[model samples]
Every structure is written in C-alpha cells, then in structure tokens.
Target: MSRSRRRPGRCRNPNWFGQMAVQLDLGLHRLGFGMEELDHLISDPQWCAEMVPDLMLAHLPSGNDRLSQRNVADRDRFLKMTAQLSGFRKSVAASSGIFLGAEFHFDVVRPGSALFGINPMRGSANPMLPVVTLESRIIQRRHLKAGTRFGYDRSFTAEQDMLVGIVSFGAMDGVLFSPRPGQKISVFLDTHTAPVIGSGGSDTLFVDLSDVPDRACREGQIVSLINHQHDLETCAFEHGITEYELLARLGSRLPRKTCPIVLPPCIGKQGAINTRDQTSR
Candidate 1:
C-alpha cells in the first residue's frame, strides 16, 4: 500500500497482498502490522515473512492537536514493535515516503509517482528521471481572420488575423487545461514554442502559429505538450488534478503499451510506443 495518506481510498484497504497478511493506514501514521488476519498468520511459526505485505511507515495528516498527539504516540508504540521485528527483514517505503529519512527505508521500495519524476519530497529537489513525455501531431494549419469566433459557445474571439495549427489532441485527449488568470502558456514546437490562444476543443487543439516558420508548423509535425522541465508537475498543479489522475486522463488513442520490452507491431494503425518508466537497476 502507499505511504502517503492523500486520497485515503486509493492507498488503503488493498486485499490482494496475501492471506498471510500485513496492513497499514497512511492517515493512521502506521508502520507496524498486526491486522486481524496478519496476527493470525504471524502466530503460526510456519508462516514466512515473504508471505505478508511489504511493511513501511506511512503518514497521516495531522488534523488537530489531539489527533497529532495520538498519531505521535501511536507511531512511537509501533516503532517499538517494528524494532522487535526489524532484524528479521527490512520493509519497503512508498513513493513519497522515501524522503522521510533512512529510518523509514526497509530493503525495498515501491516507486509510484516518484518513478515519474514527481518530487517525493514535495518542496525539495526531485531526484527521479522524466518518465512520460506527451506530444500531439499537427493535422492542419490555417489562417484565422480577425473577429473570428470559435469553439463551443464561441468561447474564443480572435483579436487579430493569425495563423493557427490544428493539432491532433483535444478535450478528449485530456489536454484541456484551465489556465490561471493572465498566465502565459505555450506548447513545444521544434526548438521554439507556440502559444495556445483559446480553450482546447474535443478533437483538436488550437495553437497560435502566425509567427512560426511555415515548415516547422506543417502538418504531421509532432509538438510536445508535456516535457521533462517539471512540465508534468506544473500541469498537474495548475490544473488542480492529482499527478496520477492527470496522466490517466490522457486519450487512449495515443501510443501506450505495457511491457517487458517486447517490440511487437503497433496497435491498430495509430498505435504508438508505450514508454513506461522504471527506476534504473
């Protein structure tokens, strides 16, 4: 289970580890295990540690003074229990808990969002490599006249005649981002960028390409929407979506495949390579 307490429903109550079980709750600041089933398993001398869950310290938010004190007290109690079990095997830490300190590190760790360059330590330096890079291909490029009104309910009105590129991404693609007031946002086009001038549509994204080179703005060109320079994080933060949710929201038509590195033919006619990132061995 996850060590960070956020979205309690996601990281809690997983029933798949084993019948030889261990359990934890992030909100409970739990590390040691003695769940109903786990206690029964541990009582049997024949049961091995490997059959249980990967034990790790998880954080629950400090809600109030009473809760804070209780969490600390409970953590101390669990620490003592964990110490007794320590020599038997090292436990594992979750994505965000790796930075909690060496005391939390067992032998193994589950790299969740951390595997995708999300800062394990929220305010600290990110130590992971870039995992997913999102891009969209251009399908058409054309000129927009001044006073042009477009999009659903005519949400966009051109201030001047401008050239725009119709990229192969849209609301259905999970790229419809709502910018904060007066924010300057753009997309990566070759060595430069093109500004997004309006709300993203359902099947196509509109980018201002009036000043860009004609060749670079041509059809079939791939433009990066998410990149390594903290772009993924920025997008998630600004759009008020969890990192995992943002990634999951992307369209299914784009290239994505799970793997053990089997390079089979692409999916259908529009298939793209799935670049699932793994921590270096």
Candidate 2:
C-alpha cells in the first residue's frame, strides 16, 4: 500500500488499466499493507471501485517458523479477511508452504527458489532436480618434488612427488582460495575427485590430480566444480556460506550456457534435431 497515492490516479485512467494485486503483511514486514490498513482500504468505496484488484497475495518470508503458533494464527487471520473478496484470486504459498498442507495453497502458488533447484525448506533434503553445472577447463599441470612448497604463501608442502592440475576456476569465480579449517574442497572428473591444493590465484586453482587417471588429468580436460554430487548447497556448506551467497558470488566473466531440454519421443526426430542444432549453434 506504499503506492496508494499513485494507485487511485492510475486505476481511474481507462487507458492505464491493468491486472492489479494487493499484498497483505501477514508477518513478513518486508512489503504489504498491515492488517489494520486492510480494513481501511476495503472500506473506501471510491478506492475499491477505482482500484479493482484481480489478485490477493500474502507472502510468508520465513519458512523456518512457518508452522509455529504465531504464523498459523496470522495465516488464519489473513484467510478470514481475504475470504470476503469473491472475485479476487489468491496466492499465499511458496516452496516451503507446499509441505504445510493444502489450506495454505490458494488459487496460485509462487515457488521462487524451488524453480532454480534450490531447496525451499532449509534443513530438509532437496527434492528438485539440479539444473546448474559449474565446470572449468584444465589449463596446465605441474610435477612437484617432495618438500616443494605450492601456491600463495606456500600453504602446502608436498609429502612426495605428485601431479597437480591448474584449473581455470578461482576465488574470483565464487570458489574459495583455501579450504576452511576441518574442510576439504575438491573438483571432480568422471568418478574421481581431486582435492584443491593450497591457496587460489585470481583466475586459477591447483588441484591434486595424482589420484585421478592420467588421461583425465590432461590439459583442457573438464573438471566439475559444482555438479550433482557437489551441488550448490553442498559446495556452499563446505565454503562456510549459504547457497544464495555462493550463487550470487559467481564471477560475471564466466560463460553460461543452458542445457538442452529433452523432449519425449512423441515430439519426433525433427524436434530433437532442431533442439540439438540450436544448442550446437
């Protein structure tokens, strides 16, 4: 209701008409009209007639306390108030709300994080398919002798002769330079995982490739930084940060490509070829 001053004028203009929505602050405090303001807003005949809302939405920002006594009570109050509006479609649920039973679900539901394969409910196993894969190409390989110090500040000293692969990913690309205490960060290729060695450079990180097959450790080989086994949530946890922060910190310089959608057999050969051709191009 912060846009109350402009709504009346905009709604009154015949040419400016569009689908309108009202947000009620159930408890989020981020946006929306307070419970007291809702009564005042609906009571004004001029305002109601002019601003015809098509949708009524109330978002629950915190999923952790969703089922708490206070939240349930607030949700009930919101439902009671909005039930009177016969014409308006309602949406009160998000990703976490899906598990809270059907009552929270109205005419529509908005699953923001879930759409991006992020877990809607914290501390629960994720049920969404991973849609993102972060990878980097191997740039170089090094053979270090026993007692050889590696990386910035010589954080790692080789215990024996080993092969190390330098990857294109680094701290600038949302990867940590050094693992946190009691944690080990790694990248994968096929079934083998290579632990990161020492600190990272601006655009490069060293991985202990001795355990990986020689063929897989070759130059220009692809290494999975974030994958199904090492998902965003898992990687973020090892980095001592949230999944959101890890995603947001991804370097702008990194190239992004969407995975081709697999169509069912019913779509025919032409459709499959078209998708492949587009992806290839």
Candidate 3:
C-alpha cells in the first residue's frame, strides 16, 4: 500500500507493512515503501519482522467519509502496493471499493450491502437480491378534529378533520419524522398496495386514512415495509443517518420470517437431466 504523508498531530509515519500482509498470504518475502524513508524502516531486519505480518484484513473504516474520496485514497494505495509486490494471487475489495469499477475487481469482491439489496454509493446500479421485509400491526383508528395536535410535543396539527390509523412501528422501529406534514410511504397489505403517511414522532408511525378508503384495516392488520422500488441509502439519507447505521438500527422487536430459496437442477452434473435420450436410455 502506498503510504500517505502522515496526518498532522500523528506521531508515527503512515506505513503499508500491515496492508501488505492482508493482500498477500502468509508467504511474504519482500516489502516496498513509498520512498527512501519507508525503505529504511523495511531495511531494519528486526523492524521488518515485527511489521511484516503473515495475514491481514483491510477494511474500510465505519461512519461518515467512509465511501468518499478518502476511500479512493485507501483503495488506490492498496492496489499500488499489491501490484508492486510479486506472487500475490488474490485481492479483495470491500463494498465501497467495488465502486471504483472493474479495475478494482481483482480476484474477489466482498459485498455486504449489495448482498442485502442495498446500493452503498449513490447513482450506481445494484445487482443483488433483496433479503429484508418490514411489517407493522395497526393498533387503533380515530377521527381527528381540524387543528388537533397529534403526537408528543404537539408537532402536527391536522389540516382538517380526518381519520388516522395508529401503527405499531415508530422511530424506535427505524421510522423517522419527516419535515413535511404528509410524506407518503408505499406499503403492501397482502395482495393490495397502500400508502402510509409520515407523522412527526421518534416512536410512532402514522398513516393517513383518506388515501386508502376502500379497505378498512382495523386493529391487528399487518402491513409490509415496501422496499422494491426504493433505495436503502436514500432512505438513510432521508432519515439523517448513515446507511450502515440505518440497517443496524432496525429494531429487534420486529419479528422475522425466513424461507429457503431453491434453484433449478444443474444440467450437466451427476444428478442433472440428460436431453439426449435414445442412446443413453
């Protein structure tokens, strides 16, 4: 890995010895540095033994600036170091690093977000299967008077007298308050689709009753959190948090149901079907 000029206030110079261990396997014989200063460090046999690691794992730091220009700096440095070193068979790039394009796709790509159907970077196409669903139960429905205060702190005052449904989900369940009065979120109810409007709160999700007037969803009705056409990162940004935190913050009270996905039989393997019948039969 190419070393950067150590950031201000940092005592030790930034070195690539640790990063080199991760890209290459246990058998590392040589070490390269950014310039003569790093080269001198590697020259010390005792220092080389201590710094030269057998195996290493390079991961992007969490929190903000994770997928920004600094990510590019780290990725480029690692790529450069790997290229300079010989006999390195495999290299792996993490989620944001893959966005550097196919040039960064070495032997393998470790994609945690894409595997869960989340596009980490904005404006990029995601090619992974979605694996999460959110559902909420309705608790109550009431008709509100015009200018009635809703929720704690009297955040929302009704525009006019309207019916509202109290849902089980809230900010505790990852629902965030919207700046606008009525932000519509698409939800699936069995075979039917409907909209759930956002009401200001950190612990309650509200739905406008006027939007879906046909079917009456009473207490104990289950609604799915719609994820098909929306981006998770966009949702996180809307919620004023990082994508990783948004996923991590999903409340544990929500019950999860898992089902196995089966693929079609392999065509040419041992248990595969043979199309050529006459001679084989």
Instruction: Report lDDT (CA) for all predictions.
Output: 0.60, 0.77, 0.54
TM-score of each: 0.68, 0.82, 0.59
- On residues 232-263, what C-alpha lDDT tens digit does candidate 2 reach at each position? 88888888887777788888889988787454
Q: Give a tens-digit lDDT track for model 3, residues 1-281.
A: 23323311232246632443432221122432333434444455655444444432345442123346655665555565454334434343566556555555565556676556576455546544455566676777878999888776776678888777777777766656353433445555565555555454655667766555536566677766535444465566666676667778787866667867332354344333322221121
lDDT-superior candidate, 1 or 3: 1
Error of 3 at 271 (Å): 21
Which 10 consecutive residues of model 2 have the lowest summed lDDT? 272-281
Local lDDT at 273 for model 3 = 31
Cα RMSDs, all models: 9.8, 6.4, 10.0
Best by TM-score: 2
Clashing pairs in 2: none
Number of the candidate with higher lDDT, 2 or 3: 2
Global Cα lDDT for candidate 2 = 0.77
Model 1 local distance difference test score: 0.60
The TM-score of candidate 3 is 0.59
Residues 1-281 of candidate 1 have per-residue lDDT tens digits of: 42222223343454655332234443453453344333444454434433433443434233122223554544454465455343334333466545544544455545577766666655556655566778878898878899999866788888999988888887877658535567756788888788876777788778889878988888898888887653778778767777778887887777874434223464333333222212210
Instruction: Provide the lDDT at 189 for model 2.
Output: 88
| RMSD in angstroms between candidate 3 and the native structure over all alpha carbons | 10.0
Off by over 4 Å in 3: 1-80, 83-89, 99-103, 145-147, 177-199, 213-216, 230-234, 240-242, 255-281
